[model samples]
Target: MAGVSRYLAQSIVGTLRQDPTLNPLATLRAWPNLPAEALKRLNQADLSLVDRALEQGGWIWEPTDYPDNLREMESPPLCLFGRGDASALSTPMVAIVGTRKASSYGLAVAEFFGKGLAEQGFIVLSGGALGIDAQAHKGALAAGGRTVAVMGTGPDVAYPAVHKGMFAQMEASGGARVSPFPFGTPSFPSNFPARNPLIAGLAQAVVLVEAPAQSGALQTVAAALDLGRDVFVVPGPITSPAFRGSHGLIRDGATLVEHPMQVVEALGGGMIQPLPPEEGDDLSETQQAILACLNGGPMLTEAIVRQTGLSAPLVLAELTMMELDGIVKKGRDGYQRGL
Candidate 1:
């Protein structure tokens, strides 16, 4: 309670009076006087445990240390618990979210955008859920860049449990996992919607990779729009139900992005320019042929092989190398020249 102001303590008491549960935003909204029981409950919280966890895993921060973008939110969290580099929270960020039940195409789009944006010095932010979110985090880590996973549970907890390794890697790579919730909080269904606003608040923009009509990703999009964050959607085939929400977003005026650079350019505020090829970065003959195949636009591996008369395996190998070399990028649609 050291950092808790008199007004905040009063608000917490007020919120508990209405519903025994603590609702941070509601507390901020109604600053009623502290009732005896609520005040006792507030005083009884185990501050020692929170302090030990903060000292052991990471640091705790108030609004002063929060990212300026997040702090501007109408109902920002009073305190944040974070692991890894706290500085990353202040950096320009892009949130990429989609269905937990993502398709291969959706995963690829998430990874492509995740890597592309991170390479340009933007921190990739996501929910750390499976499918698209996991791939997004993987892509940023693969690029040797930073990413921040805004959790729906406690900062110390990896909700799905499968992502504990990822949570460690993020911190090791100078990225972070953050939460507004206290330590030991479980991944309750209610926590996610509450967590969505933080994801939107931390980002300059939000990208919906592939969301179905009833997807949770759409909820994040709503929060992003409410926060005045730019929203971008990756268009998908009309035949696919997975794209229904994204297409609707496009129709409603969210920018449609076929490539990650479009998102970068759209959110421009001194974003780093794409690096020029280094000296002696000349392409081999096969590489040149593959590049030519993609000159028209992004093309599938099979299409590139057919156009360049290269074998399928050879094309795949070459494309993989090119992607690592930053010569080309692979998206849900296919491969295109890197930005």
Candidate 2:
């Protein structure tokens, strides 16, 4: 079995070196000792059919180099089908994963980590699943920082399909969509468990925002433990089933993370200077007005309009611009100072 593991690992590395378009996991799962029975029950399928479907979807496969560091991670995916520059994968990254059915609190925590990590110069990683994962990716990209989506399905096909535009936007903004499965690989239940390890391997740590007792997100926590990487969980309402798995992990010894700073402190001594306080780009007058409105705590757009004397339309436009500039965030009721 050790021989099989080593060979399987080597096979992926070798495949990545040759066919840049190849997704090692999809093809390599065919090997003799790949825990196929378990994965098969999970409904995993090969990518041969997926490749053809993507051709009709107008997707293109582009090869990019993986950093020597990433290639050296324990059993890294054979190759990743990337929608943008693969180099973004090499950035210091932290994985933020959680339940698909998330509470409002859980979603907020995910976004906090996303924006915080991006500001701290850490690339954010997530599965691009709905709920928590989606919020995290949105926050990171909103921070104007690098983010990578590791898919359980093919990079060409957004699994939920609802995230299709988000995926394209990420790629266009120098962020990337990556997969260990070939194009058109329908997101099988089985594919995600296998995909968990890849996410754990890519990150320095895995953060479980909110996981139900039987959630697949737990698989990632387990993989992180196996890989000797740190695992962190945000404390949620004790009564919430969404927090059951995470609480179990904490009881078993995962770090309890509340603020995003805790994560940064865990990664290194402390957060490095995140995105510079200000980029060289000059702020527009309207953007300046909006920032002025957020003098202290989170502020609503109505308050901003009243304070800035700007119309709602003008205030909203400036707010969007500030969000893209990484200056502000939309909170539960309104906008707030973002990381």
Candidate 3:
């Protein structure tokens, strides 16, 4: 329903769902305001087949019942297909978006906010992109809270494909994979940009953890501003190109938030719990020794083994766990503290 106005699209979906005998074509054609493009696309295929497909797979959200915040968008979605319980959308949401090629620091920041906000009972919202977006989802799940993924493709097709397992877990855990794109829609370059507004509109605010000057996360920021929603940015290393857009947003008056609680509290969320345990607090003595070995800065595995006087195999195993826990992150030189 590309060019169809909100008024006509909702009426059609509402009517079509009511009675099977009501001719889809006749109902669609009756709308005097229906654009030629929308009418042509709707008429070319079998509406009965389309209706049946929608009925058989997952669920559909007509415009009439869209999330309240989402209805405020400049161009609200006409319909959405979802693969999990849509009730998660009713929770207060905060959008966290960043570059697909995220840095160690960026990933840490994304996950921190994700877990922090989720623990306080806000559902994290993001596009299911790689890097930052993926970590955000993982963080919420780690906290045993819900998260939502707004997809550029349809609900049935996980576009990057590597995220199939994560998508499955999201559905099983009450989070949703939602999209306005129809089933079988491919990953088009333009589709993501088109879907950014949905992310902005669905969340109370958007947090940009990291992005380059040209990163598309900025598009969501623009959409948030258009809808009069707040935009928050997590500052990254000033010298790095990946942070240029993030810093620019800060300089131009977007709120600079250092942690998830700041965003949550600003959005009026209750403090459900204190901050998560400090980094490295739960580590074994052996792990603490490994941490001490890298006090000067990042170091190679061999160097850490030599300094910690531990076996190389032991150091490797500990380092891997550290990376996964967001305690330390591997960089070009070696592993560095994620902070």
Candidate 4:
């Protein structure tokens, strides 16, 4: 099996070099000489160190284990290198992507979506970058849910360095850190555009929290669109440049989403189980009134106040407390019942 795996790896590498745009599996099956030529190249290289590194990092490839969602891509990666529980890939996934220079609003929205989706049994997926990506992963982790980080660098390489701890926690928590790049690959700007598709491909839907007109998150959105994956964009303040790309996407017909459940519903809500009710059966009268106001859908604090005849300050205070207690969630549109 080891020898067969190495031969298969060589064949994929050689085919990629010949035509980077071609599907390697198809090429390998169609051209009999492809494997021989690949093996020849492999003979000339030293792979002992690579094997050692893979073993040390707990990296392995299970070609057959590629997620069904990703396999539908026009050009999915020939193989994936992953550390930790790859089973997480089989779960319903939603990718959250945004600018590395995210604002507080962007970070909060990303985290809220991440946590809410996780609570509903969806695996949150994202690039392992700073700003929004980091916050998304943190939110999922806080919820004690799995989250996969699709990386541009090698599976073993932590690109931002600051996210090294987060990556470690992901692996420990039965989530995965995955990359299609070869071992020892460094973080390069050129690698990220290529990496974006994998992030989009792994998810049933993609969400853009915040992105500038030129943000790399747009690349992922394009890939998602090409693959026919549902694309959702959070509306940002018109004055903020960080949301320019997201607004453009909405204008181009992408679904405009304010709450995470909006995303779940757009993707067909059957995949996720309903979240259990919040603890503490005894609810305050104001809390009951607020919940009553939100029965139709999400409502703003002011709207809830008007319907419940509560003061603005009291409504705001209760909403904040409820959000922390998992009784409610705040989105761009307003406050809604939590998962």
Most TM-score-accurate candidate = 3
Q: Per-residue CA lDDT of candidate 4, range 204-268, in tens? A: 88989999999999999999999999999988889999999999999999999877778877777
Candidate 4 ranges beyond 4 A from true positions: 1-49, 270-339
Better of 1 and 4 by lDDT: 1
Q: Which runs of model 1 end up more than 4 angstroms from their true locations?
A: 1-10, 13-48, 269-339
Runs of candidate 2 with Cα error greater than 4 angstroms are 1-74, 269-339
Query: Per-residue lDDT tens digits of candidate 2, residues 1-339?
Result: 112454656665576768978665565555555665535632455546555644544233322355654554576665566567566777788999999998767776787789888878888899999998998998798788878888888777777889988888788777887787666666677677778888887788888889999998998888888878889898877888878999999999899987677888987857444352463246667776777777677888788889888888667656754664467878797898777
Across 101-167, the per-residue lDDT of candidate 3 in tens digits comes to: 9876777678878877888888899999898999899888888889999999877678689999998
lDDT of each: 0.82, 0.75, 0.82, 0.80
What RMSD does each model have against the real structure?
A: 7.9, 8.3, 5.6, 9.8
For model 1, residues 24-76, the per-residue Cα lDDT tens digits are 44453344564654455455445565767777777888777876798778878
Model 2, residue 2: what's the lDDT? 17
- Candidate with the larger TM-score of 1 and 3: 3
The residue pairs that clash in candidate 3, if any, are: none
Cand. 3 TM to true fold = 0.76
Worst 10 residues of 4 by lDDT: 1-10
